[model samples]
Target: MKSKNYDYYLIILTSLILLAIGLVCIYGIIYYNFLAVKPEWSSLYAEYIEIMNSYLYPFLVLLLISLGLCIPKRLLGQDILIKSSALILGATLVLTVIFNLEAGLGFILAVMIGIQSMVLIMTFRKSRAVRFEKHGYVVRLGSSLLHLGLVVLIFNFVTLRESPSHILIFWTGTLLITAGTIFALYPDRITRLWYTEQ
Candidate 1:
């Protein structure tokens, strides 16, 4: 990667880490409507602090790194970083699952993350042989949207039961997934507006 790109990535990584920390600090403050009795928010917050201090932080670190690894080659650049990151991601996931390590949302995210990485890697390799893919940007954008929708769907498992229905997000994600699939699989059939190049 170029120096400018590295700088941007560094900025992004710093921002994501800061955002995650902020989220973790505010985690227990989230209100759920269905509790039979108002429990001690302070104790709950303390318990989570302890959990994070004990071992959860490492898992979060790994997760953030995995997220970074999954950045598409088109966004990050066509570098060996993608391949290396994929290998590291797969190894971390397999070892974590096999060893029975525990972290909140770790198991669910692991499966989806692994699958996403594999799919992206395979597609990156296979794209060169694909035919009827006239507009490269459309396919790449669609692939990114498809993955984003899949991730959104996966997060449904993490929400509280009493929280507002995720159906709206679900349908929106379905739309993105459908549109993305069409853009990726039938690029040639896409309208002429996407063809800006001669």
Candidate 2:
């Protein structure tokens, strides 16, 4: 039987979901920072922080679910899946230690990274091996770009509070996200010449 074509819709949907979440998080962080400076907003800030903290776990869960859906069907084999999962977990652990991440939030972040990494690995493997149809190539490239953008945004989010170069990081993340969006939405127009050869 011929292999099933990739689900471009699912990839785009998942990327949008992730981008929405990242934007929400960035907004929350920036708003919180702004509120911290004003004495009158103390009560409001506290409430906002409480609400964000309370919903964090559920949000992480949602992110994981969306990311899980982005994984290609080709990577569903038992051995490859296990290996990919292990690799993700190992990398997450190492990063957590190196960064001195907090216990609770760090664990959640690690889990999120692990899940994203698994999907990314699967996507990369499939895109490399398969000679995708035109739409398939676009979907693969778009999804990969979006994933890369999300990773940058996540890193920015994590360090937003503590980093001295906050403005620089913020701009970097924004640029990445913009580029990803462009790539995802206009893959055909953007790569028509190069992709024709493939």
Candidate 1 stretches greater than 4 Å from native: 1-70, 77-135, 160-162, 193-198
Looking at candidate 1, the ten consecutive residues that score lowest on lDDT are: 28-37
Q: After superposition, how far is residue 145 of candidate 2 from its true place, in Å?
A: 1.6
lDDT by residue for model 2 over 1-198, one digit each (tens)? 123423465456667766767777987888788888887896787788766754454454345444433332333543564465456545644654676433333454445545445555655566454332335555665555565456546555654557787668667657756765776788778678566778
Per-residue lDDT of candidate 1, residues 51-138 (tens digit): 5444445535454454545443333343665675666566656755676433334454555555555555555565552222234656
Per-model TM-score, in order, reads 0.38, 0.52
Worst 10 residues of 2 by lDDT: 66-75
Q: Which stretches of candidate 2 lie over 4 Å from their true place?
A: 1-41, 68-138, 193-198
Best candidate, TM-score: 2
Deviation (Å) of 16 in candidate 2: 12
